[model samples]
Target chain A: MSIHRKNVLGAVFLAILGLLPLFLNSYWVDVLNSIGIYAILGLSLNLIVGHSGLFNLGHAAFYAVGAYTAAILNTHFHIPVLWLLPLCALTAGLFALVIARPIIHLRGDYLCIVTIGIGEIVRIALINNIFGITGGANGIFGISRPSILGLTLRTPTHFFYLILVFTLLTIFLFHLLEYSRFGRALNFLREDAVAAEGSGINTAHYKLAAFVLGAAWAGMVGNIYAAKMTIISPESFTFWESVLMFAIVILGGSGSIFGVLLGAALIVGLPELFREFASARMLVFGAAMVAMMIFRTQGILPPRPRSYDLFETVEGERKA
Target chain B: MSLLSIQRLTKNFGGLTAVNNVSFDVEQGSVVGLIGPNGAGKTTVFNLITGIYQPDQGAISFEQASLLRLPTHRIVSLGIARTFQTIRLFQNMSVLENVLAGCHCRMKSGILSSMFHFPRQQREERAAIDRALKALDFVGLRDQAENLSKNLSYGNQRLLEIARALGTEPRLLVLDEPAGGMNENETAQLVSLIERIRGMGITVLLIEHDMSLVMRVCEQIVVLEYGSKIAEGSPEEIQRNERVIAAYLGTEDG
Candidate 1:
């Protein structure tokens, strides 16, 4: 699509989304909130699985860490959940750094397997209540609702606005990151590690950074999730959650932001829409996913190649 | 003084010595060629120099700093950039982005600066883009900057690799079989490109089987046979050396 048309389409889409909560009932607004949450999570995962080409299937471990951190701290100390955003991000980022440091060098399927193990380990640890702080299988409860300027976010509509704003911020920041020197380095390493290394990119360092950054962002989303639900458990973050996030990125289009958003909508929102189908919904969803994979192997919206406006300068040089 | 120095470089894979007791000097601002038959370990030497594989016993230094224990990316940062024999371009990225990746080592934007587009980061990014474009222009691929690298012709892909390597602004540029699959016209263009690279005061080290192109562009030539250096001299001297000739064409007894 032309840049102008894309901008117009994006604006119209955002306007519709902005006004969606008013037209829909509470349950549907909550669904949009779910999509928003998944969209942010997918964007975070995209940094690793999409741009950096790291096979990270344990992303939920970071999310769980973030949620548990908030849940434990907020329940015990009565600390406001909103105040723990940065702290949650820190804990999750640090957790990723510790895990990824040793295993970042493993390639492809091996990395994927290791990440799956890590996800399971985190879930089991939460269940076992290793630190005695996680509250074991029952999980932590009564997370204080997030608030701003003395106004608590009590309803789905309130949380939707919060999620929408955060999602927009994520898209903006990630958009910048996607075009930055750092983003380019990640893409280069993803394409060909040896060539990227020979071209002066520190592959291991960049890979580790992507893991940490993606985890940190997911952690922040975990804080929002805890606040929205007001109760947290090991059940909320599972191998299945990580799989959904991964699928959202891959099925949506790995490297494109708009694609991930569209994917989050389809993956998260479609399942809800299919509820009327009862038992047949999953079969339809599965077949649809298979067909999409076969038809658009690159994703629903593959990222366009980057272009620069150097033509004018080049033409001027040629004339000169 | 030599720009890059290798002393007794040896690498063993299981029972086989891919490179053994090989020592050479690449003079500053000179084009040097390493020639050998198949499985003669020409690419292995490049790997060792670039730190892809650590030598079992050797001291490889660039500008007097040892590269023995350094990683491949660090080697490039210390002013050595290389192109692979198989043409390893970022196939899905734009031609310009491929070269921009080469400018990565020189860029200094951290995550926050990059995400926020701070003035310093923007300036550095603009400079990197200009440098990348200049490298593309040097290789005659400026017009294809926006195209995906995989969409480029095979010969153009090779040129794109060179352009990507040049984005590093390296003091020594290493190429593995740059003219391996190029037609005559492309090979001729490669010869002139190598000349222009040297003209810009960069030292070059290359491994090539194309003797005609090598003889025309290389000021110094090193010949390897069965993982050992057999001859080191000017192109004409290497062409006439008995062992070098015998290595290329089997001896009567053999």
Candidate 2:
């Protein structure tokens, strides 16, 4: 069957999921909500990791920025969680822009290191000086849930719908972005930065844009995460959490939107499905990632071009 | 004013000088070739002009604006674009998509408009797609627009690279080894294409090792050796210049 048909069927399958909360247990509903959050985070990382060819290991920094922004806004001012969603995303985007000038110049492992450092810094800061407001090691409690048009998301069922909507929106946005001009530019940059620049793409600007936008998407998810859990702490935005997001992108396929969602589901949902394997979870995850690198480094599904049959002859040339 | 002027442009790589004190003028709507032996810094000159490297001294002006300090994309926005010595089309993209990427800097849209698929962004995207198709057609690869750049034949890949460069609608297009790995027939086609590109009123600056191809198409030739200018003249004049002959053709008379 054609790729287009396959995509349509996938969409239809997802459309049927609007009623899943009716059948799923509350525990499973929580798993589903977590999957939604991770899917958005994974897809956001794909923009930089897959499309822009920039390795960002500290993506959780944006997640932290988002969480903290929402946490502080709601905890102190008693602001509505829904009102702070975009604000959180914008804050993370601005943070990305601030560091993008110097950071965008870094590549591969260096970029990874810097991002990792940024994540650590953000976490450390939250745990230290901001303790008065953030509650530091004690963490914040009584965090309010999101409400929409007088509807409060107090239960797993209610929040599942909101999370599901946001997750689908993130996927749709990423899908649109992957086919857009900016998406093409990021792909070009990923393939070859020099070539992309020569082609009249402002490589620095596009890289920065990708960084900022990716952070913003992750931030939106973080905002939802803050509301869902009704508590926040630096511990929630740890280095391992960032690594987990990276794992999702890499395990699924860095640039593929569906692959990201798939990765998120596997990483987030599998844990709940096999809670008996709790002690071996991290070990199994590590082994799977290593095996994937050894076997299918590109992930379960490599990112296919938006346009099919784009360059069959180039492959022929390589083979020749 | 001359369309492009480089006066005493110099670049140093640690202890080595890659581009040393070179100066030249490219008039508007002319095809100029930069030729040299291996490591002659021909590509280095291209790098300097395109903002890949900062010249230690001297100035580069395009349309009277100093391009020395401008970033690579900014230089491109100023109507200058280039291709690499190796074909560098976005390998996974369609020939049309690759060219469409080239057109990105020229198109205008707000972030919100692009994100929301606003009517304005859609119109610009449509225009860009049309322009991309036109560019591919110009390179005689319109039929291959849907083909992946990496899947194109070597010659077609080179042509796609040129087409992608042209997508920026540049007034000045720099080609690095346009006919680098092409067969004879492909080279002949490239010579004509070079002519056609010039006919489109775009000034061309090229670096090539293919002597016959360079001699046939380039109205002016600039020779560099060890990052320094050795000769600058018309192609006919360069063919006979003893220094060029010695530096390039070398001790072998043939």
- TM-scores of the models, in the order given: 0.97, 0.93
TM-score of chain B of 1: 0.99
> Which candidate number would show the highest lDDT if scored against the true structure?
1
Where does candidate 2 stray beyond 4 Å?
A1-12, A129-131, A308-320, B249-254
Give the distance in Å from residue A6's predicted Cα in candidate 2 to where it truly belongs.
5.1
Docking class of 2: acceptable
Tens digit of lDDT per residue, candidate 2, span A167-254?
A: 8787777776766777778888998888888777788888999999999988888888889988888898899998998999999997
What lDDT is reached at residue B156 by model 2? Answer: 92
Cα deviation of A159, candidate 2, in Å: 0.9
lDDT of 1 by residue, A1-320 (tens): 69899999989988998998889999999999999999999999999999999999999999999998888899999899989999999999999999999999999999999999999999999999987998899988888888999999999999999999999999999998887998888898899998898899989999999999999999999999999998888999899999999999999998899899999999999989979889998899889889989999889998877666564344226322
lDDT comparing candidate 2 with the true structure: 0.86
Candidate 1 DockQ score?
0.79
Residue A78 Cα positional deviation in candidate 2, in Å, after optimal superposition = 1.7
Local lDDT at B5 for model 2: 97
Off by over 4 Å in 1: A1-5, A311-320
